[model samples]
Target: MDFVSELAVARYEKIGEIVGKCVEKIEKPRTFSDVIDTVVTDKYVGIPIFLSLMWAVFQFGYSISVPFSDAIDVFFAWCAGIASRIENPYLASFLSDGFFGGWGFVLVFLPPIAFVFIALTILEQTGYLPRAAFVVDRAMTRVGLQGKSFIPMLLGFGCNVPAIMATRTIDDEADRKITIMVNPLMSCSARLPVYVLFAGAFFKESAGAVITLMYVLGIILAAVMATLFRKFIFGGSPSPLLMELPPYEVPTIKSALMSSWLRIQIFLKKAATILFIGAVIMWFLATHPWDATNGGELIENSYASMIGHAVEPIISPLGLDWTAGVALVGGFLAKEIVIGTLAMIYGVGEEGVADVITQHFTPASALALMTITLIYVPCLATLGVVRQELGSWKWTGLVLAYELILAYIVALIVYAVASVVML
Candidate 1:
């Protein structure tokens, strides 16, 4: 709350006190909810508490989700092995490498996605999400955004599609436009697999910290960009935040889990449809010309290699190779496909991805790769939403161009700084 809001609150409290002197009333003890609100929304500790909880959420989700994800990875490999053993070679490749390999690779990360949603559900169901917005409200307005903008940015942590849609709550057109533009920078759950893959491969013991860094970086970048947009594009102070904080409620385990699953269904459906098609297309590009390439035995001669090589020069300055370029291309469609693309190229799903991935990137380049993934072009779905919501392809194109430029510049800086530090 700002000075005005605090003053308004004080005035109302004084009025209540005066009324209490004229009428008989019972004094009730402060409730548990009151105690929680006091500590959580405290002036000094509120922001720190919010940051701590965010770090804990990512760490908690990553640590507990490993076994479940590993189990799924193993199951898919078993099915792929069965498919690979068929008598006819082409059919076997199509089934083994095309469908199962494509979809199964992405599915392995489903557990982590669900776990993240579960964590978010706990915070939201308990009404801490609102308080979180409250805790950050002053800082938000300071950056030329309001508390309502924070809610959509918070939702962006789960998915940008819904996050962009959530901006409908912001009544100011300028505020809503700025939020939509910056929302894609929020590091959606779709990017989680990329973070997990790179962090596990390079950072290992500090994977949780690396993951946490990405989320924090996303928020920082979003705020900075929002400020820039407001100063130049929108040219107006943010509307004051006015929202009622709901009472806290303990979320039931069953309800939390159910709601979490509901949120992940969108991911599941995308994996079934868009990602599966992407997988098949990715498989074909990398495995064609059966006799010439000897059935994916010589991937260098495959079409996928040609595409990767074409994009290599553009990304090479960042210490990345052609394969990373190709994966990033897949990323433009859906962030999860970045992982799936790598899985297909290596012929190893998540279970075996770590070993292969480490060979491609040193810790320096790995950080750069993750940074680029964090800020580069929004996915196809997100771009469509931007065009529809903003009702302008011109603005949509600007979002694409600016993000691409910013991502490259930031990624280069990260690579250069990391390289020097490691020395």
Candidate 2:
């Protein structure tokens, strides 16, 4: 019995040694070629993982924006109150309502925008986003674009101007032009407020889903538009998508924070400069003809009111009233200014514009308006860049005309469909 027990112990020890060796081999560091081999062999899991990462990114944008946005609102309200107590009402109004409100609107969105850029930068640094482009390459090729064009499109989600500028990376001039044209359709962060506010107010249960759908719709529209342009207008063969995936590394928290801070700074500077001017202009329009009888409230009989009334007829078919028309016009300067314009026009304050819009506009109208905003002409900054890069106003004019036509057509379709279904 003693000899048999010793023999069993010896056999068990040998088996344990073999298992340890197998585990060490499995845990060995993967070589570059080894990783590529694995990726090629297991694309199913790799593709899903890529998608899951994107979903997490969108989730991060929504989650991080909430607290930061609230803080910005509080800060702006305090500033506005302090400014209102100043001696000169016009100067105070210009500082608080026009400048602060306009700039504040853009500033409040920084957290989410920064988070998105950081996440994307991390993905870029870690080499996964290129892989994403690789996975989507076939689909992009079908639409007459190289997978590399997606890099700028992804960047456009943070801001469209830089994304347009980034198109310089594309080798083919025709491909680059097409890329610049479709980058706006990727639903940049500037448009996020519209999507989030409306989705929250009207489709609370499906807010995330609805927002996701809008993003997908934007991408689909871009792909279709690119395909059509290539087939008829551009007249070029699809470019080959070629990229090398870099090895993954642990993303530094410090680097990520710095990236976020820089982005926030850029956004703030834009708010302070371009958006400040826009907001003041909007305020001048919305607030004038001092109403002494109405407790000094800025009356609608001011200069801005006259312009709103003038443009109302043209935009009313899209379900936008004169007030909405003003907002649309303001949006031409910077897409984000629409919310601020509405806030100022409705006297709802910057944070309250979404709520006021929800209260006044039906879901159908709101959706239609959102669609129009999505497909409307590029902002001044974008158009300037387009003109500079394309080297002529001809393409810029074409883009504007095409987008306006598309916006009107799409807005009408959405309105018609919603009216029939909802009724």
Candidate 3:
């Protein structure tokens, strides 16, 4: 063996001997963690176990959260009914249809999102999240990413802004950049509302499996893109996976609640500020160009329609009309807004959004839009963090340019394939 290789082997032997000397078993011969880890961290079973766990998470998450979502929907409907009874038409429309209708659509998603965060927090606090990283580290290594990069990628499932920021923990510049570049493919919870809306509308029986497929597709795409980037954009060998795994423990209720609350707070804050502003602006655009004859037909005569029509031709191949085009434009600001924009455009409010969507979109088109949504450039907030982390607008622009092109290509491919099978 080479001199450096021999030294590394000697150091590992020394460390193992030291650990063996210091540690001893107490009462239980082999602890509970040891038995669980044998199966969970097994090279063969680990990945499949992780996937099965994720499927169950989504299934339980959506199934249990539906009643709470419906409760929020009923509350909004009551508010809309009260506003509709108001004497003044203009004020009533603005309050009921514009303000409540717009923002409430995003708010109703809180149940499922909270459930996801709670589950993720429990996994994280129990220390299984790191094992998940370890389980996938080998797969990541094959794509030229250090196993350390897996943490940031995992964080991306919650939100990409912090995920990109989390890239700072990665020591290698190329590895960090690649991780940041692909983090958006992790499918943040904000996108879940869109998936649920459409999945419920079209694929009612298999909504959980469909959503799981999208998550899986995101992972597959991230790996493929990482491979391409490593082969062409940047060439580097991955660092070896070397990290201590924590023993599993029953997570404290307080710790799990705190973690979940922190994530939910971010969502609530965005809903109040950024999402509220975007909704108001969209409402105005869909209501303006004041005239008497076409006063009530909000979207058809408004400025938003103009913009949507202009972009319609570009996205028409995916079976998107002007309304869908406009929603896509707003989705650039925040993915959660995509469903809200659609709801607003249809004048259906939150409760009737799925029905309206079905009237407008074919199964193929809906699938295509969902695919695009999954792969598109992350919301504007993520771009700012990307620029800050990369320290260059050049890289930020490259990230945007490539994601757009890639999204379009992937969406078209989905449309083509789905069309063939359905036909």
Q: Pick the candidate with the highest TM-score.
A: 1
Clashing pairs in 1: none
Query: Candidate 1's residue-wise lDDT over 1-423, tens digit each?
Result: 999999999999999999989988779888877889999999999999999999988988899999998888888888888999999988888888887787677888898888889999998999999999988999999888988998899999999999999999999999999999999999999899999889988888999999999889888888899899999998989999888988889999999989998889989998898888888888888787777668876778878888899999999999999989888998888888888787677767556788888888889999999999999998999999999999998889989998999999999998999999987
Q: Give the 10-residue window scoring lowest on summed lDDT in candidate 1.
A: 343-352
For 230-317, candidate 2 gives per-residue lDDT tens digits of 9999997767977777666667888877876776677778778887788878787777655631322654676666777888897777
Best by lDDT: 1
Ranking by lDDT: 1, 3, 2
**Which RMSD does model 3 reach against the true structure?**
3.4
Of 1 and 3, the candidate ranking higher by lDDT: 1
Output the better candidate (2/3) by lDDT. 3
For model 2, the stretches where C-alpha displacement exceeds 4 angstroms are 1-51, 290-299, 421-423
- Candidate 3, residue 186: Cα displacement in angstroms equals 1.3
Question: Candidates' lDDT values, in order?
Answer: 0.89, 0.77, 0.87
Residue-level lDDT tens digits of model 3 in 213-318? 8889899999999988888998978778788888888999898889899999999999998888888777777777745314436568788889899999999999
Count the clashes in each prediction.
0, 0, 0
Pick the winner on TM-score between candidates 1 and 3. Answer: 1
